[model samples]
Target: MIELRSLTKNFEDKKVLRGINSVFEGGKCNLIIGRSGSGKTVLMKCIVGLLTPTTGNVFYDERDFCVMTKRERTLLRREMGMIFQSAALFDSLTVLENVMFPLDMFSDQSYKERTRRAKYCLERVGLLDALSKSPGEISGGMQKRVAIARAIALEPKYLFCDEPNSGLDPKTSLVIDELIYSITQETGTTTIMNTHDMNSVLGIGDHILYLHEGEKEWEGTKDEVLGSTNERLSDFIFASDFLKKVKAAGAKS
Candidate 1:
């Protein structure tokens, strides 16, 4: 599990995150959701150690990650897997190579061992036959799958996804969502996803963190979210016609 304690991030003089506290349980899809510029992205970056927070601590399985030395952090990173907003695959490399990149850089595994593990990871993501394919030769959804395969190649204990469903059709998005959910269950990874996709919120958001202009406005499960009395959350989530129908149906259900 991951814990955020009074987490705060600043840029120049502007504060993006403001003393937020939350618990991201392991073996579940913990979602950070908000409107654009709600500081959700900043919070994710801090949790992933990509950005240094001005104040506060990020604890991974109870250890404070904010103060770790470079080597300590690098070792910690070995346990982490990340899928970015874009698949961010190395286009020049084959799908298998992309998945094997982590092991190549971090593991003592031989070429044959890396290839075997990478192939297994690809199969897990339903990309078994695409090993030799380049990123540019595939569709957006397929590229996302490759990214996921790469993320899990090392069998990481934690998974972080940023806007994972961006630029995909609804069906593809749901597939990716289900894949992540299944992976979390299989690996017991502490999964944190940053997204504005409400469909994803209902589909796999075991824990939801709602951010409002840099503050943690509310936190709850999917079922609890429908009954929220917090106007900001209600408006932010139920504002769209699509979400309105979903929530209305949720109310009836």
Candidate 2:
């Protein structure tokens, strides 16, 4: 599990995150959602160590990440995995090789061992057939799958996904969401995803954190979202007529 205690971040004179406190439990799909510029991305980056918090503690399974030394943090990162907004696969490498990259860089495993592990991860994400294909040769959804494969290649204990469904069709997006949800459950990985996709939130958000202008506006499960009384959260979520209709129907039921 990951816990944030009074977390705050500042950039020059502007503050981004303000005393945000939350816990992301393991073996569940923990989602961070908000509109653009809500500071959701910044929070994710801070959790993943890309950016440091100005004040507060980020604890990963009881370890205070902020106080870790360079070596300690480097070792800690080996237990983490990340999927970016884009698939972010290497253009020149085959899908299999791209998955193998992490193992190659961090593991002392023999070539055959790494190959076996990478192949297993690829198959886990339903990319067995695309192993030999390059990133450019596959569709965007397939590339995202390959990226997922790579992210889990090392069998990380913590997984972070930044808009994993970005740019994908709704059907494909659901597929990716299910894959991520299943993987997190199966591996008991502490998974946190930064996304703007409402379908994803309702579909796999075992835990949801809503941010507004750098503050943790609300937190709850998808079931609780429909009944929320927070004005800003309601306005942000039910901005569309279709969603307002859904909420009304849900209320009637």
Candidate 3:
């Protein structure tokens, strides 16, 4: 689990995050969602230690991440797994090799042990058949799966995904969402995702944080989102005609 206490970030004079406080529970999908420029990305970065909070605390499983020394931070990072908005796989490496990269760099295990772990992660993602293929040879969804396999290769305690379903068809997006959700539940990992995808919001959003203009505007489960009376959140959520219709239909039913 992760907890934020008065988390704030400032870029010179412009404030990016303003005293945001929330709890992301383990063994569930905790999502951060907002319109562009709403500070979701900055919030995620601060929580992951990529950016420093100007005047706040970020606690990881009750450990004060903000006060950790450089070496301590480095060691703590080994327990984290990250998936970028892009698949972010290396074109020069095979899929299996890509998954092994983290293990080789961080793990103290022997080469054979690392290989076994990498293979197991690939199999878990159902990509064992594509181990030898390079990132360039696969479709976008396959590349994302390889990225997921690589992220979980270390069996991390915390998983961070930034737009994991970006740039994929609806079918592929659902596949990725289900995969992430299942892995989070099975491993009991503290999963935090920064996404703008509404499909993801309703599909696997066990806990949702809604940010607006650098502050936490609302927070709730997916089931409560549609019934929310917060006008700004409602406007942002039902921006499209299709979603508006869905909301109306739900209201009617």
Candidate 4:
């Protein structure tokens, strides 16, 4: 689990995050969503130690992250896994090699053990057949699956995904969403994702944080989102014509 206490971030004179407080529970998909300039990305960065908070505390399973020493923070990072907006796989490496990269860099396991672990992760993602293929040879969705396999190869206690469903068809997006949700439940990892995809919001958002103009405007579960009377949230939710049409169809039914 992760907890934020009065978190805030400022960029020179522009404030990116206000005094936000929230709890991200483990074994669930905690999502951060908002408009392009609403600061969701900044908030995720602060929580992951990529950016420093101006005034507040970030705790990982009750350990204060702000006060940790450099070595301590480095060690703590080994327990966390990250998936970028892009698949971020190396074109020069095979899919299996990409998954094995973390194990080779950090794990004390023997080469055979690392190979076994990498293959297992690939199998879990249903990509064992793509083991020898390079990133350039696969489709976007397959590349994303490889990225997921690599992220989980270390069996991390926490997982962070930034737009994991970006740049994919709706069908592929749903596949990625279900994969992340299942992985979180299976491993009991504290999973936090920064995304603007509304499909993802309703699909696997166990906990949702809505930011508006650098402030936490609302927070709730996916089931409560449609019933919310918050004007801004309602506007944001129905902004797309597809969703508006769905709402109208539901009302008619």
Kindly report which residue stretches of model 3 are placed more than 4 angstroms away from their true locations once superposed. none
Clashing pairs in 2: none
After superposition, which runs of candidate 2 have C-alpha atoms over 4 Å from their true positions?
none
Candidate 3 collision pairs: none
Local distance difference test, per candidate?
0.93, 0.94, 0.94, 0.93
Error of 4 at 113 (Å): 1.4
Q: What's model 3's lDDT at 227?
A: 88
TM-score of 2: 0.97
Per-residue lDDT of candidate 2, residues 120-185 (tens digit): 999998989988889999999999899899999998999999999999999999999999999999
TM-score of each: 0.96, 0.97, 0.97, 0.97
RMSD of each: 1.3, 1.0, 1.0, 1.2
lDDT of 3 by residue, 1-253 (tens): 9999999999999999999999999999999999999998899899999999999999999999999999999999999999988889988899999999999999899999999999999988889999899999999999999999999989999999988888999999999999999999999999999988899999999999999999999999999988899998999999999999998998899
Model 3 steric clash total: 0
Query: What's the distance in Å from true for residue 76, model 4?
Result: 0.8
Residue-level lDDT of model 1, residues 1-253, one tens digit each, is: 9999999998988989999999999999999999999998889999999899899999999888998999999999999999998899998899999999999999899999999999999998899998898999999999999999999989999999999999999999999999999999988999999988888988898999999999999999987887899999999889899879987897788
Query: Residue 197 in candidate 3 has what lDDT?
Result: 87
Model 3 RMSD in angstroms: 1.0
